[model samples]
Target: MSYLSRSRSVYGPTTSTTCLNKDDEDDDDGGGKTDNNNNNNADDHPGASMKQRTRIGTWNVLTLAQQGKLIQLANEARRMKLEILGLSEVRWLNFGEHRIPSGQILQYSGLRGENAPRHRGVGFLLSAQAHSALMKTRVRNLTIIQTYAPKFSLSYDAADLQDKENFYSQLNATVDRIPKGDIMICMGDFNAKIGSDNSNYERFMGRHDLGEMSENGELFAEFCGNNDMVIGGSLFPHRRVYKVTWVSRNSFTEYKIDHICISRKWKRCLLDVRNKRSADIASDHHLIIGEIRLRVARIPRQEERVGRQFNTRRLDDTTVKRSFTVELQTCAADIPEGGSVEDQWTAIKNAFNVTSENNLEERRGAKGAIQRSKTRGAIYSARQRYSALEKKVKRSCRRDKRAWADSLADEGEKVAATGDIRLLYHISRRLSGAKINATMPVKDAIGQLLTDPTDQLKRWFEHFEQFFQVPARPPSPRYDPPRVSEPIRVVAGVRQGCILSPLLFLIVIVEILVGAIDREPNRGLL
Candidate 1:
């Protein structure tokens, strides 16, 4: 009846909502009437309260060449209390009305392609009971691509690395299509590994190309990192004994080939990874399972339970297995110390809720770095091409000069006429800066003509003739262009032209110092 009692009643019955720890406490109001009233309110609002843990599992069912094993696998999944199940390596016959005995309904779909006949695919199995509990929704932020890369066999020696690159590119584009703030789960078997290992039960840390130390594995690491996904369930406590999927009926060597990866935003949502490894099963590969916490609305119908409320998408069977395994490793690593299963789920909820601008900026920076590296590489290539072209041009110029001098002898008659002689001598001088003198004014005049138009050339020629009282010969012993590698120095006893102004001298000195420092560390030492 009093304010304190009313306030106490409003905040009553605390439930654990913090990370990794759950503790329950009941506080009574000062007035017994407040407690009675609050209890009455709680009774009427059953939908307003209730807590449930949602379990999700992922597996790569190397499609039992037999229908019976497939059904058994589905039933086992149900028996395991898996509310949501993702399966890879599902043949078409294993889908579309095939009965899963757990009485659970798998709302399934597959990728569109010409290989449909092979029926190799990925899908989701919703416990029919679980499906009946929640509301249904869909999100298509990323494109789920299922591909079986070429194995390094004698028949296919050429590497499928390029194909893998293109596939990842497409996958990233699909992930980008999803708008920010929307829940997007891009999961499946990416035939790549974080790294090679003999362990199926132990934690296998993924590596990146950054260094020899493993972060994630090669292209797989790059793909998952670029999309911000975690490789769940791979970091468990057991070494893989039978790791390979898709085994030939007679082959004995088993390889750990499948993997699962998820966005970093959903890191906390991951719970546990279960891998079934008994060799007695008809399927060659072990069944992988991923457990996830579902935050369900308390008041939903059976179909509206957490099942329908959580966003779901279908993946290829092969991809599902791969991603499941990857996620298994990642989830194991994500488990914080001293947290309940509930706490782990809560962490995932908080982690995957929404991507912040900080995340986008980080991705942008990474992409920008890649783009810049590519741009720099292209610039270097262009410079190399230009340098090659410059050398070729120099060689051709030298050859042309030799040919022109040889031709001068054939035009001997032109040397006898003034205008013809001037033209012939000009051409020769232009071809090679090897001759000149006042007596041979034609040669000197030709060299002057190179720097000026005909009018200025004529004036220079006239001035030369009048000053020396003879024909204006080209300056004997023509000037040769300096070689790039040669040190520029005025010869002893040779006239050095007028020097530049003091300001120009200062600028030149500063430029020289900067250039010297940039090109030669020894100069700085000096």
Candidate 2:
């Protein structure tokens, strides 16, 4: 099928997607050669290839339009352990790739206005899998080309045929452009259906197809065969449900139109392919997952960490404070006449760190809390027990923190009794809270604490909005007591020489005139 069927006519919202790839294309300096030696000359710095066993997936996420949904996408990607994920139907504007805050590289293409071109777009979220959290560099050559072809129409007209031809022609040219040494993967919706029959296409496709092959399927299979690419989804055996990549909204039909194919030279890399029905993104198509084993040519290097923090809160004790001061002084004395400024700074830094290490306690609760469970999302009874224990630990930590706050509050009361307002203010702040962490709770208008960063920002916005906008107040009530006639006095007349005399007289005259006008609406300047 090369074009959409007339029956599935364009009615509802079009699918928007994005594609992300960690693999790289050849640099212009390579002169289009596929030699590994030439690719390693430092100039052809390629991204990380799938040289190790890793999971990759593709899904047609209807749209990434909702607020805070992008993080959810990243979280799901992490949960699925997918290193490279190709997305379809991403409704975003602009086209390019950049590293997100999550360290994943997101590459995408979209149109300027409300709708994307041809009711489709490409997006990708390539996870940063380098072992070193500091140096997220990938080295090696590999390419993944994702596509969404025109549908197969009921009437095989010239336009439909021409569109299909254009897609395949471009696809063929793209596949030919990739460096031969670099592994190439082509996957996406092809609008085709190859039945279980794998007659002449056995070299590329297997006998595990979903349904009867359509005209588009025949052409698609022919295209793959000509390129020497093996269809990953068909090679593996799976239940019909697991094999189906798309299901109709009516729940009456299913099709495995989406496929992941790799060049025959790298066929051994693909371990398995299946459809995951549970990964919901408000789409009818199920997520297609594939496992591949790759080889890396370089080992990732990790950067060194420095100046780890100790529990300096212990320094609050008089004894500990005195001990730390003495140790710091001792260390400072040993700083042998420094060589350079940088060296002297380094020595001083080391002195402080060493003294703290020797005097203060080490912090362990947070590190232990995260490292306690290595196997994420494990559903075994052990996982349950670990979860329960984790909650208990958090509760105890909170209890201890509250107790500490209580003690600080009592101390603050004593300081207040001694008229130490500055210390009391600091203590009050500690007893309250600060935005030290993203997960810190902030009270909202309804008295509920909001932990979500977006919600907290909104609450703060509301507060600042009212705080900066001055409010209107009623004018002070004017009082005028009954006056009695008296002789004029000349004692206050000498003040006429003052600079403000004329301005003050003008203000009093204007005020009286305004009051007279208010009492008599017919009064005029005349």
User: RMSD, each candidate, Å?
Assistant: 35.3, 20.8
lDDT of 2: 0.63
Q: lDDT of each model, Cα atoms only?
A: 0.42, 0.63
- Assess the local accuracy of residue 211 in candidate 1 as a C-alpha lDDT between 0 and 100: 16
Question: What lDDT tens digits, residue by residue, belong to model 2 across residues 203-232?
Answer: 898988788898889878888888889999
**Reference-based lDDT, residue 430, model 2:** 62
What is the Cα-based TM-score of model 1?
0.38
Task: Tell me the TM-score of model 2.
Answer: 0.47
Question: Model 1, 367: alpha-carbon shift in Å?
Answer: 48
Residue 377's C-alpha lDDT in candidate 1?
67
Instruction: Report lDDT (Cα) of residue 320, candidate 2.
Output: 89
Winner by TM-score: 2
